[model samples]
Target chain A: MKLELGKLTIRDIRFSEESKISEGILYVSKEDLRRVALTEEKIKSADFDIARPGESVRITPVKDVVEPRVKTEGPGGIFPGFIAGVDTVGSGKTLALKGMAVVTTGPIVNFQEGVIDMSGPGADYTPFSKLLNLCVICEPVDNCEKHQYESALRMAGLKIASFVAGLGKDIAPEETETFETPDLLTGMKAFPELPRVAYVQMLQSQGLLHDTYVYGVDAKKILPTVLYPTESMDGAILSGNCVSACDKNPTYIHENNPIVEDLFKQHGKTINFVAHVITNENVFLADKERSSNQTAKLCKMLGLDAVIISEEGFGNPDTDLIMNCKKIEAEGIKTVIVTDEYAGRDGKSQSLADADKAADALVTAGNANQLVRLPKLDKVIGTMDYISKIAGSSDKALQSDGSIEVEIQVITGATSEVGFHTLSAR
Target chain B: MKELTILTNNPSLKESLTQKYPYLRCGIEYRDVNFLKLLELVRDEVHKGARILTHPLDGSVKPMETPYKSILVEKSDPGLDLNSLDLIENAIMSCRKFHFDERELQPRVIKDFQIIDRTLMESAIDTSGLY
Candidate 1:
């Protein structure tokens, strides 16, 4: 499978009478976008706002962030399962509106939601602060169930992102990049001298709020499976879980996964980049055992020499991570696992709930427990009612001076397990 | 039908699960305890040969961050399951590492935590096919 990813850099974004991408500036029609968001009756109101790179604005209780993209010439659309038919994607041309994101925020679904400060100390930890964010604040109808509200909010973000991306369908891209993944036999033959490498990605599928979807199906229901790496780039996977804001892979990260990008850069040079194996992190011990066994089996069957594994949330998933590492290493396959640490505020605690001697080659995505102080910003895009209740925040989070002191966990993408940000330890 | 038992500190979950399923078929053990205490209870049950059906740790919320926890386990027996014992012991240790103080949380926030706990258990029950 091959995909031509066309990128159109968005220098600026503002509300205008019509929606279009003109001369690297994205002009959005607020009413039109709101209409798209309100397509679901469960969303009582939809409001739009814009936060730039250096603005004194904050977006709180953020649900998901999605990059605007349109499949200009492909067998399937941008988001295959939800917005488009479940046709096989990752072939043909797709245009992405770079330098901008559609950030969805609303009433806190759970305590796991995050915060994104556009400027000041908090902005340094989160990558979203640097993007031109079109904030979508949607309120659910009264008496709406928590799951129903979460679904409504998740769909609203995707719908608005798709609508915004449609404006770039006819525009010529400023840059274009191509990614190709050959069949297993051809790939093996093409890179006979290089070491065969694969990536094992763990999807959060603990339960209702902690879930991921592939081709519109709850990932928990599916067994370990393999996919062409380009499939994820074309929206074969999506983030629907409300995990910790920092380490959670939002829809935007799934669309522009740093691991996939880096791996592709090394493809055909230092490594073979064989395939992407996806597994779930379930709540049941039996499910964990079965999934990890299947994952290791797949890696061994692929004839892989080495594989890079990345996990979503911590704790419960740490057990899954260790299980996969131990099982795969037992097959004589070298493994490097990527994950974040909850090493206590002082950084003097166990990094993971479960560990094994086999997981020696590991990459850490910083510590989510490290505390930081976020100075008050002038403007707020979303309600701060839940700031004190969010993960990594305390009841004393709100101060008389209007500043907040919280763990980096409250900041979105602060310690992305996929290496989405630039934070590293000495 | 497989014998299933639910141990939870969330009163709402206990009431809902008990009302939905027959008492004899699905056992609901409701205990008034904090998050760590609830895990201790599950550990005690596991020592008596109860097998854990669901993960003791919730994926999203930290241990001390939420006051409620719901764990599903098989009926007690005379023989112990080493896997269950290992998992429960690890979960207890993991909970102690996080030092979040949830005592000062507002009522609305506590209610939100309860809902999250209940929903996760509901998902487990949905896949359990016990209904």
Candidate 2:
């Protein structure tokens, strides 16, 4: 299959009489975006706010962040299964809003909703800080179930992103990048001498607030499966979970996975970049065993010389990461695993809940336990009520000085597992 | 009854602990792991109340009859999923942050041994008082 990505560099976003893109500036209509978000009755009401670079703004209880993109020429549109039909996307032309993100925020479902500070020392760890964030804050109707409310909020982010991407539907892209993945035999034939590489991406599927969706189906219900590298960029997989703020793969990260982008850069040159495997991190032990066993089997069947395995969330998933690494390496396939650390506040505790000597080629995405003090911003998007009770915080987090002390994990996308950000420890 | 939970991530800490604190009775270890059992303890002397025991890993074990059955989860307030939520909580709980530039992870394990010493001393006092 083949996919061509047309990049529409979005330099700025503002409210306008009508929604459209001109000179790389996206003029979004509040009524239009809110209308799309409130389509789901689960969301009591929705509103739009903007946070830009260098702004003294903070968005809190952030549920998910999604990049706006649309398929200009394809069998399916962007976010194929959920936004559009299951038409098997990633085979045609697609347009993307390059620099802006649709960030969803609302009531804290669990203590896992993250914080995205637009500026300050706090912004250094979060990747979303650099993007022009169109913040959507939603409130659930009285007494909506936590998971139901989370589902509504998750879809709202995707819908708003889709709505904004529609503004540039007809605009010509400034640059286009094409990606193609032929059948196994054809790809091997083309790069027979290159090392065959594959990517094993784990999805957070512990259920409740920790979940991921593929083609609108809950990932926890699915077995390990293979995907085309382009499909994920086209929104084949999405973040539908409220996992701990730091390491969870938010929808924005999935839409523009750095490892996928990096692997493609090396695709035809040094490595074959043969396949992409999607696996789940279920809570049950049997599920972990089954998934890891099958993942190793897939690697062996593909004749992969090496593979990169990236995990989502942490703890239980660490076992999955190690199991996959050990099993795959035991099959004679070299493996590199990407993960984050929880080496305690003092950086003196063991980082992982599980570990093995087999995991030699490991990449740490900083210590989530590392602390950061975020200066109070001039304006806050979400409520401060959740600040103290949030996962990384105790009642003492919001201090008398109004400066909040928190771990980098409280900031959204701080220690991304896929090398998504520059924040890493020695 | 007072209880002591061993808090350590060292796998060898469990083995070394049995030899280090011979008087301390062993209890169930709770880890987030799916395994049924992690260690074994056979006792010739059963002491009543205020047990000092340790199960030094991440997961939580099932509740047992003894008061000291809580594993690393209950022993430490550092949070359950060490790599994600716990990392965030512990870092914030410290109030102040410090960087560790040392390449060695030896300090963390060494500190766990010290904890074992202090906890065992307290348990020894409690066990002897039962007379």
Candidate 3:
């Protein structure tokens, strides 16, 4: 897949107490740019046009810097994606995912709605969605009497469900897209016959994948199913107040993180470690600045990667947090995560950005379409559309003319108030 | 015909300076000489076209609140005796680049001293429970 990516320029600034005796100039560093300018090494070798006192000295246009170039446009269609329905306590994340399934299926899909009462954010739905196409309806599975799984199948209106006589024969086209209604058994108000559907009963562990069979009209097909721990399968989800509060102290980090030993387990995957700082209510308001400086200091003292700060601290464009880490990852530091700076509100934003920015930022940051915030449903649907379009195109998403192409769309939904949500591609 | 001169922080070192430079007369002008004042005298004498010789503890040399100062001689005349003048000049230059502040400039200077007490430092290590 051709990933449309933004052009990057790296400028390292070093300062003295008094004034800058030397300063580097800015220039395009992409390989394509190298075709026009002399080689960076050669240019730097030449007299750097002695910089006058305050003027920035142009070191040979930083050349041959590798930048992300989009190889192809995204696919067209729903793009076969998943949604993590993360919702806080009392929020309607499961209902929303179910609602979405109904809208896409084009029928009155009345499934037995499994309800669960919880006190914090819903379960992590991203992993579950990855494991199964079926939206895992989360509920306190032990207490709930009627198996929600069975009830969902019953709601699929068995009458509307088509049954094939032979196991291998092709089913009628009309029977493929059936919405199991609760009352209708054979025929629906609109369609003459019902489509094929199936009921499944299985106990699966969290994050584990289970195989399921659907007895549709055409043939039996097996698919993956995931077991989620909560009822609200999707929506905006975040760290609970308790976890957020506990993540601050340096002592807590040492106590929590296994450090070099545990790091091996996630050596290649991104792992963010949040360190909470204890502070009075008054200081919490301005804690963003204080915490960021502290994070930088701690990271430095440990002799950890300097790039770790990019994952741990707040920055402008909000997207820099992601793009910067992507740059680090590109350099062979396989995994990246913030080990500190998750204290203040902005820290929370940066923490979430660290997750989304890694992939989304590179592909979407430079797109001019970034400003338009679509309604919530529209955003999800639009992402499908954009992905489909890009995947279908032949022209490289990264243009030869040296211009960045982006399809940034702000997905506006009834619940933008839920704050930031973290999504990892891997 | 030496142009460089050195002033001693110690009155006794003045005799050593005269012997080292040979070209210029050494010793206090006996006008309220202190560390900084001696340095000012040497620099003034050097500017006045007299060759001079000095030691590391030249009275003319001033040390800040820092424990050690740059120990060197100021040449009032560059055209004096090259051999002996060069020896003193090289010695001062070597020490100039090496830092001799509160920190040790040489390992020998702190060989037996305890830079940090191992037991005390270890006690400060935090064993308290982390949040």
iRMSD, all candidates: 1.5, 14.5, 32.0
Best by TM-score: 1
lDDT of 1 by residue, A278-390 (tens): 99988777788999999999999999999999999887899999999999999999999999998899999898888899999999999999999998899989888888878
In terms of docking quality, model 2 is: incorrect
Off by over 4 Å in 2: B1-131
Per-prediction TM-score, chain A only? 0.99, 0.98, 0.20
Q: Please give me the DockQ of candidate 2 compared with the native complex.
A: 0.03
lDDT of 3 by residue, A1-426 (tens): 011111121122222232111222122222322222222221211111111112211111010000111111222211011111121121111111100011001001111011100111111211111110111111122332222322232222111110101111121211111111222222223323322111111111000001111111100011122111111111111110000111111111111122321322332234222111111110011222233333334333322332222121111112223333454344433323432221122212222212443433221111111211111110111012221112101122234552213122111110011111122234
Model 1 misplaced regions, further than 4 Å: B1-3, B19-25
Shift of residue A287 alpha carbon in model 1, Å: 0.9
Best by lDDT: 1
Candidate 1 lDDT over B76-116, as tens digits, reads: 56689888888889888889988775447677777888888
**Top-DockQ structure, candidate number:** 1
- Using all chains and alpha carbons, the TM-scores for the candidates as numbered come to 0.97, 0.78, 0.17
TM-score of chain A, model 3? 0.20
DockQ by candidate, in order? 0.66, 0.03, 0.01
User: Each candidate's lDDT (Cα)?
Assistant: 0.89, 0.72, 0.20
Worst-scoring 10-residue span by lDDT in model 2 chain A: A387-396
lDDT (Cα, tens digit) per residue for candidate 2, span A103-203: 99975443567898899998888889999999998998887766788889988888999999988999999999988888899998999899999999999
How far is B112's C-alpha from truth in model 3 (Å)? Answer: 71
Q: Write the per-residue lDDT of candidate 3 for residues B19-96, one digit (tens) a residue.
A: 533553322333334334544554455455443322222110112211221122335444444433433343233223
Model 3 chain A is weakest, by summed lDDT over 10 consecutive residues, at A98-107
